[model samples]
Target: MSTTSTEPARRAGWRTETFARLDERLDRVLGATAKEFEKLRVRTVGDLMLHVPRRYFSGTELSDLSQLRVGEEVAVLARVLRTDVHQGHGGRSARGGMNSRLTSVISDDHGRLELTFFGKPQVMDYWRRQLTPGARGIFAGKVGEFRGTRQLTHPDFVILGDHGEIVGGAKRNAVLAEVTRQPLIGLYPATAKLRTWTIAQSVGLALDQLAGLPDPLPAAVRRQARVIGLEQAYRAVHQPQSKDEIDGGRERLRFDEAFALQLTMARRRADAKAHGAIPRVRRDGGLLAAFDARLPFTLTAGQVEVSEQLMSELARPQPMQRLLQGEVGSGKTIVALRAMLAVVDAGGQAALLAPTEVLATQHYQTVLKLLGDLAGGGLLAGAGPSTDVVLLTGSMPVAQKRAVKLKAAAGEAGIVIGTHALLGEGVQFADLGLVVVDEQHRFGVEQRAALSAKAAAQPHVLVMTATPIPRSVAMTVFGDLEVSTLKEVPAGRADVGTVVVDAKNHPGWVERAWQRVIEEVGAGRQAYVVCARISSQPKRKSTDAYAEDLDTDPGGEDIEPAAAAVDVYAELSGGPLKDLRVDLLHGQLSSEEKDAAMSRFASGETDVLVATTVVEVGVDVPNASMMVILDADRFGISQLHQLRGRIGRGGHPGVCLLLTKTAAGTTARDRLDAVASTRDGFVLADVDLEQRREGDVLGASQSGGRSSLRLLRVLDDADLIAEAREIAEACVAADPELIDPGLSDIVTHVERQAAGDWLERT
Candidate 1:
């Protein structure tokens, strides 16, 4: 047999070993080690194959010695400049010398590194010969520093020939083709329990056993895209022979991810079109027109354009699946209200779902204020030919809740605004033609599906978010829906300025933040004091999505918790703002207490509202001219922007102070600085995506220890995504049901990896 065939036969024992079954359960193949793989969610051989390396470290990609950090495990491929064997110190060594160390100086074009070895004369001589001047090899070791110089001690290494083969270690001519593979180290996303090398070994074993895998991409499509076949892609990614192979492998995998996702979206669009929706067309001089005519200010051009688009979609027979992404304080609520009024005009009820009770109440009051007597349909004298707007919430008195439910059931309530309570049983809409979800990310897909299920037919869905989504994200995250952006900040909005206060470098700035709040309150305006937590306790409720705001690490060393709402409220009430009215609000508070606190603040009875991120959205107090966010580094870019949005309303120039103890050069501090630098939500969204992984942006779990994207970079691969989208649409057009089982399987796998809300089932 040829040396290449014999090497695998001898090392793998493939002569007796059966071919690895791709469909085999991991537990069967991995034995006890299967438990470790389970942590990474690799349950089958196929899953293991798909767990491609996150990155490869090759000679060209290795960092120079100057870039090495102390106590870091690293791999370096460099030319050996010189070698010296010496004995050091007075202490007796195993060979009767003071721990003799061999130092070899190695260099790349950029810098040099020291490789130290400690051994007897024979071993030292061997190393000396192997690491002579001008010799090139791969050195793997943990970096250390002695006398301020970086060094690697007794590193694991392989001396390589000019052609990249292990010198004198194996036969040259017969296995030259196989052994000349580039010296590249594939780094898997590893965990403490399973190291990267272990995973690589397992992958190597699987590759050796498996062969001739079916290609999911059609032959013609593969040729058109110029991507490698599935089997070749897997082999290249897992054990690439060259950098070109790695690139080819990653391109195919990226295309696969994008194609599968786009196909799912295309199918969803087709299904939405197929499912009939009653056209809730507008009526002239109806509630929408009446509401629009009485507007205190002219609608911005962006709002008018989006509103027109929404109305036209609502007039269609197909259900409208549209996403309205707007900047903070861009008057999105007004645009949504107009659409709701249009639905009411068509004799159908519109249900608006808010993520929080506070937001629901805010919307309820806003609608009532905007409608004035027009909201009192059939219930009051001198009322217009309008419709009733009702607020439904979990904390409402049982009798009041029952009455509201009956009105909704009897078609008397034309507009229903509520939290998740609207999705509960017995809350019926007589003719639910529209469903509007505010802060769409706050709820899951099941919640949205539940609300839509209430309508007799598929309800025209309009989901809105004040946190502007980048166009790429909108295409990937909300691919199933049509996207509309409202960037025009209405005229007369008070210009808001943001400043980052470095509490660590300048502790006085924190005190100044509190004083600023006092100053705003003294000027007859309100202010908000926001914190990252409700308490200093280390505990966090899993149900609270914002629990990440707490700076405490659950698994690492105990830390001094970030500022808490309750603690800040107490301190301010007694110290800085003793003369002013102050109240506290957080998710832990009872619903009544939260409402009362918000009400007090809204009515100017409370000069300062100390709260957690509960005030991040929809609690509008236009008179609130200042915001002091403590431990602001804990909040995200989008969240900081949203909290800042609460201010600068009602033509009161706003000031936002971001207080953070994070050091100036840290990533956390950089995030805070970015937020302070721009008020544009879209710019911040891009910054946020740049800082976070694609999996985080999509809200998917890192199943294989890396992003669900694996190899696809959402921001950098926009052209690839667009091409995949085009190809996907064409594929769906030709085979609407995805008759090819392989293509169907790919789509199903993609759906499993995504957030469940990305797809909606009829």
Candidate 2:
């Protein structure tokens, strides 16, 4: 097979050929429906070959009947001694009802084994005809013991002619030979109607068409990476002869995926560098220095380091596409503010886009407070130029929103902060130089691109996320953007203690957890009761709500029954926490109601606040020392960590109680235990990445779209990703347009990907 795109156009190659040309209805060949084929996304011969097996099942070695143990999956070849059927004990039909056992005794040279077929009369009849007295066959199933005798239940078997002699001569011999030759059975990721056998057969047909397939990766790159050719990798992945072949093939394909992504990103970076950006570089540092001087607390070393990096990037003419990642309560906001100040100091407008209205409002308040007199609407008097901070949100009054828009368009507002409303059609900036995105993952690629497009010159973009991303994940999901991490917590920040409360193992633990919350409230510290849902109504129930707990009313008449925030808030307020001031908060609540509830909690008027995961990010409260998470297992590790961060901001020791109804040994319990064991966000991030797949980290799973990665694993292929990145950087540096003959396919693929989604195309 030719592994080169440089081949003549006249050459017949699988890489350039469409599946329709080979066979329009590949569904017929695979014995699957069109819907099933669509699910696999198989449109070409390449796609068919790319549908690798999810797992492989090894055929058990044939074992003697006497040596078989109960619960052991084994294969046995024996001759049938006798067959019999008995009626059910409860006076039911022996063949169709409760008592249905088609029993047969099969014997090898060493001992005899019993076979039982239950509720499968057709199979029983077929087996009876095939496995008559002294007839031989091969059987495979899990061993079971009934009445002290070893037996096989619902065994899969193939009869080899008769016991005395082999019949059908060469034909029968060939069938046996084929079965004996294949020891491993591949189990593919298939739809309900499409079995693994059909997929395997179809793949076999596709492999035959792999001759002269042009390889996308250059020969030199493959040699340096130690990866096999494309054709070999595909064959080994689908029809491997040994474990080593499978490993080798997977590694090669993984490298290919990583390389493709890195090449696209490298080209994008190069393209951005070629474009001119309005450098918002500042030397006097008037606004930034003034803002920093007024801060009540000192900056951590990590924050200082990251802020310097951002300043340096802003000094360059190329637009800065950077991601600032930090753990909860790590002072990322301070670093972002400094960068924004630098831009504004250079006579440019800066915009901060938030994912939620609550977060946007909180950021606006934080920036206003931090800027102090320099934020000169009323406080500064005559101190230099007046820096007006404006807020715009979907829920804001129309008149107020119009005023903010006017200020933004006229370049009068030094800083503008808002949610998706900033991406609205009418919103525009006069000299937009910097764009800061908070909780960056919550927004899609299109949203970010839309904001960037508002600037006449490509704006300096800074994306910030409190959710710590593992190194491997950062390399793949955020490969296109430069990364800066804040690993240090600010001085005097209190440590949070996390505990897992096994509600299933100990029934009374739930009550004890609530009692802890009450005790925290009594101590003059606020408490938070986080639920998975927002309301008890079926139609209004959030996707994360626990279905079983939706109708249970622990508190009397006035309160509704549900595990949602409204029901939980009512139950706690009217029940155990009756004397304490409790308030309800959730996404379903009106903007004014949400603002009021948060304000009351912040002001200490509400002793306890019951809410959903809406409080997971950007909600800061110093007095809230305790958090009780109901159905904690439903939340991801990163979310739980962010929620825990809401407390312990006031230098008081904080406690996090995770209440889970799941059993101890399940995957859910394991995840909860991981969260409770440590407070390190980086460690928890790695664990989170392992627990879920790459799709979750990239936001593809939630969007109902396929992940950009097809073969690479963020956890296992870190080294390969690094290597591919180096090669891609070099490749793009040498040929920015990728017009080289060897790289034409890559250019075409990248362009196609970019046109499909804002993420891949960029």
Candidate 3:
């Protein structure tokens, strides 16, 4: 060959050499000193670290022979009493072409077992010569079932007679019962090479060759978390010596995960507090007094306590960053109104932001009613003839919007209520002092920063979430912000006694309930029929018929009105109830339509309004007493609680009917029963957590990417998580910056937690 032609092979050899050297460097990087295989080309050590299991075979023990089920790998020791070479059993020859031909029978005193050596007559010859017929040999092999009998197929056996200890052992029993397994053996799963012997072979090699990988967590982290190192963790996880070790490792991982999360939250809070520039205002109690005096009912102790704490925060110079948490109907709004009043009386503008326009309108109207009568000059009336409160919803008239915009910009709209639309670029505040955010958990940390940036000075913010967070979770998730809970309900409000009724019994319940509503309305009360599905949801194709898609709802305008689902709305409004002012209220309706429907409902124009859970939050129709659900089982207990909260605001003998359709399934019945048992939303939340896992709870993926977790479980280790979180706090308190040399490795670990792809390597 010419030199030019031979260059191609030379270059190929060079590339292979380069690859080998790179792999060597990677191995060094992964702390490997010696390369194991000289011929095989390997990937980077980092790549190898990510070689988790395709599956786990989970090892076993031979002692528990009775526990040996049909599908288990059992190891036994036996003597090879005899060996024989023959042609293949089923009329095939072993001494020929590449075929499954050679057969050998291995025998012990217990029995004779056949061993097949496919296409390898030399294998039999080697065994016969080495084993020496009638001399004892040790067999380390897999047990296979052949013709309803246990047999060893192509077993790996060694002659033990040559060994000095077993020189004359063939006279005794040929089989030895010294069988031992890892007890609960963990396997590296199988591949296409799936004979029971195949997986066993790979595992045997791996166990012999693989070294225990070290966990990098420092001693301080382990001591603080009351846990073990990474190697111990892996061992305990796979081949746990005892139940206690397994539990201990699990505790360590849980604590580590929770501690990481807590540190992140704490760091964010501390950084924000440190970097923020807040305007401290002197204490003002006069406005709160006036607002409370005009209120209709006495404040619950929880409300009073929260209100006092919030007022104290406002009174100080510190940025009033606090989370206002409580169950449904626990009077968080009243506390918000009082805090806003405090800012208003201080001659500072205030904004009350809500997640939905419906809630904004309701809150705006409540404030308007309070300020318009007898003290009409207290709040902005927008473009309307009065000057009591400014309602800046997307549905408001353009002129009204302009007036509210101008007044809020000029520091004249003392208290403004609106949706996230209020955070629009065009809106400017004269001096935003108090910003009350409803459904706080619904918003993220970045949104909080953007909203705070809108004011002249960073405003004191009071965040509210309707979810009744458990006390333990509250401590960590909202640890940065001061927490104020509203436990007790308002006085004179009747407890909405919940009852679960299955749909197997749901035929005439709606009609019967409607009749009761008619009587209550005839007696001057209103009724609400909450439909589950909205109209815009795509209809399931007939071919794609799946039972779970039956109640799938179609569409809604986020931050707007609830959309109409034709089925339920048509059943109630287009059917027998046509005579009443039965109107549809949904998020898909135009702004004007939503405003018209809400205004009519507020003005007693619509007697029975059919809608979705869009009315769940804060739409207060005092005269609306009866709440009827069409497909109650389709919704979570939290949603059910919110819907029930819409009614019972009027102080009448209110009744709620939860009508469930798919009542047959056990899960469906449990959901309905959970709703029917109590009105305590917090308790229901705990139950909700117990039922569903973490993925569905935080609802993270819908907002963006998947939630971060590898092997961590949220609910399974709640107690461990809580304890871990406390230890993390203490650790950080001891070393505020995590600059301690001992924790530097963990600091790198935490940084990599939010970074890309590092976890995937692990």
Candidate 4:
């Protein structure tokens, strides 16, 4: 992998052959151990390489006591001149808490340091007994100020029988310098077995075997990109002597991954459309004509622009893969309906898929109102039920769903709207030509594929998102597919006045919220009260994260769960707004129940709806002009922007109140200030990316454990990511299927990642 330092030259020790044989035996033993290695399915050497380091321990060498700072990592060669051990256990806590303390003391030539261990006295005794007083050993630990004196605690210990144990016949003090001169060190992530006198350095040894692997790319491309092969990259990453080389190596690898991704997309697009061509859909100007005549107002420039883009794409014989990105209330559905009408006019059915039942019903109603007479007593005009625009959610009776499906199949309906129920057994598309997915981010790349697969020919797909992102990021991230941005709200849409209020004044703000909702309800309008958390904790990532997932308590009442969604709804329902209709909806509601409730809200049967962000994007109720978020400081910049997009869709004036507690940190406060300052989703998305990451938006849908990219922290990795994406593309363009022996290691690593079989060899 690297030509820097190949091996340790023999100095004066056991013959190299003997040591080599011992090393080989150990490797064989680890490999044959069968520690559920089968379950982990480490079936090949390649899988072993992808088992990346969670964090490396660099194992710092710090002998100069003055360089010993508290909370810093350091390594030292110390012998146990004297030793002491202590044991303790939990006596009794106020109510609930464990009790135990295990500690020890060991000294070297220069000084002595305490070793504290928690929860296990038995284990401490075994370790202390092994390193009896006067026994020499190496120690490693985090140095800290204790009683105004420098100290090392709970460090790794190595029992050295003689000076030879130091690796180069060095004393305790000389060992620091010895390690400092070397550029490589095994950095193991913090583990539970720190009491061990020695560890196998399992990952490092495994990685070494995986390094300096064969290349996998084509020679011509490799020469053009001027980049090192894969194994070299990994070595540079873990063993770089300087930051520049490390960055360069990581960039090459990141670029390679992105390039592979781009190639995959390109190949998929080509394969999907290579089949017999589908006919282009064009509106006879009949259904579209009728709908336009019934519209109450003109579309905004942003809406018009996206509508035209969809129209142009749909007009093509090749299936369109365009995405419609519109901020909340930016009129995305309107454009969808226009495109659907065109497809129906061209004798094809249209379908819109939503992530949830409530959203499906909401889209159904909006389309019903927007396309009033067209769906009501329309001359079927040869369009099917899918084009006629019916709802197909799980909440509906089986008979009703089947009837809807039958109508859609029999060409009774021209357009269909539903959740995944549309994908159920026996469901069929008549002449489905266009498919629209609301909140496209809620689904994955595969699910998106499944949605389009249901059509006869791969239908033209239009994915819509209310979460706006900066054009640059959208272009880079969505560059593979066509992206159309809806950046303007249609005329007559009123601006929702926004306000920021602290929770120290929460009661007052709550009272004011009550007054406003009551006043709005007096004129017959609904209100939404959103909350961040049910409770507060010191260790949570952030308060905004709390809002996304508010736990509910069925047994606890009175004040309700710490998350305000339920309680606030209860309070408002029974408070001054008692005369007005009010309701609650969140994840807790069953599909059918949520559907029925949200339907009522959409039809104006219910005046107010108090809920979490569940209704943030997909549900569009034109009359909902008031939104109140409790613990607003707990939300990220992007979320607040989306929440604000919910209101101000109608001609009437609306308002948004961001209520939070005074305890919010500067970051939270500053985020809120940004929210109070603007309503641009794209600008906010950039700010949000700076504040959060794609992870923030996709947190709930993660398939594996939390993401791990050493070079990519949302706050700092933008540049690295950009560079990596570029390089990955360049390198992959050189070699599509990595076959260069020198770079085979990279392909091996990625293959294992794709197979989901990443693990360590030793």
Top-scoring candidate (TM-score): 1
Model 1 root-mean-square deviation: 8.7
Candidate 2, number of clashes: 1
**Could you give candidate 4's per-residue lDDT for residues 337-455 as a string of tens digits?**
88888888777778898877767877887788777657863324544322366889877787998899987777667788988787676668777778888886565544555556667
Better of 1 and 3 by TM-score: 1
Q: Write model 2 residue lDDT over 1-762, tens digit each, in one string.
A: 111111123222323332223334555554544456675667556567667876553443223567554555555657778988654432445444554467889887688899887654554465567667866666666667789998877776655542222332212344343433444445565543454445676677667766656666778888888999887888788878877888888888888778877886786677667766788886474787778777888888898888888998998888898999998899999899899888888878889999888898889888887887677752111247447889998998899999999988887787899998998899999888899999987765456767877888888889999888888777776777899988888878898999999877796988888888888888899999999778766443232222112122111112222368888888899998898999988988888888999999989999999999788888888999999999887777778888999999987999999987777766667888999998889999888778766655665332233455777888888888899899889988878767665454554454444445544422
Model 3: per-residue Cα lDDT at residue 426: 83
What shift in Å separates residue 319 of candidate 4 from its native position after superposition?
1.4
Quality of model 1 by C-alpha lDDT: 0.76
Please report, in order, the local distance difference test score of every candidate based on alpha carbons: 0.76, 0.73, 0.58, 0.59
Which residues of candidate 4, in runs, are more than 4 Å off?
A: 1-200, 241-244, 377-387, 471-479, 504-507, 519-525, 532-561, 575-580, 590-592, 599-607, 633-635, 698-762
Between the candidate structures 1 and 4, which one is better when assessed by TM-score?
1
Using TM-score as the yardstick, the better of models 2 and 3 is 2
* Model 3, position 388: C-alpha lDDT score: 38
For model 2, what is the error of residue 342's alpha carbon versus the real structure, in angstroms, after optimal superposition? 1.1
TM-score, cand. 4 = 0.72
Candidate 3 regions exceeding 4 Å error are 1-218, 230-248, 275-286, 373-409, 423-428, 455-458, 536-564, 699-718, 735-762
Clashes of each: 0, 1, 14, 41
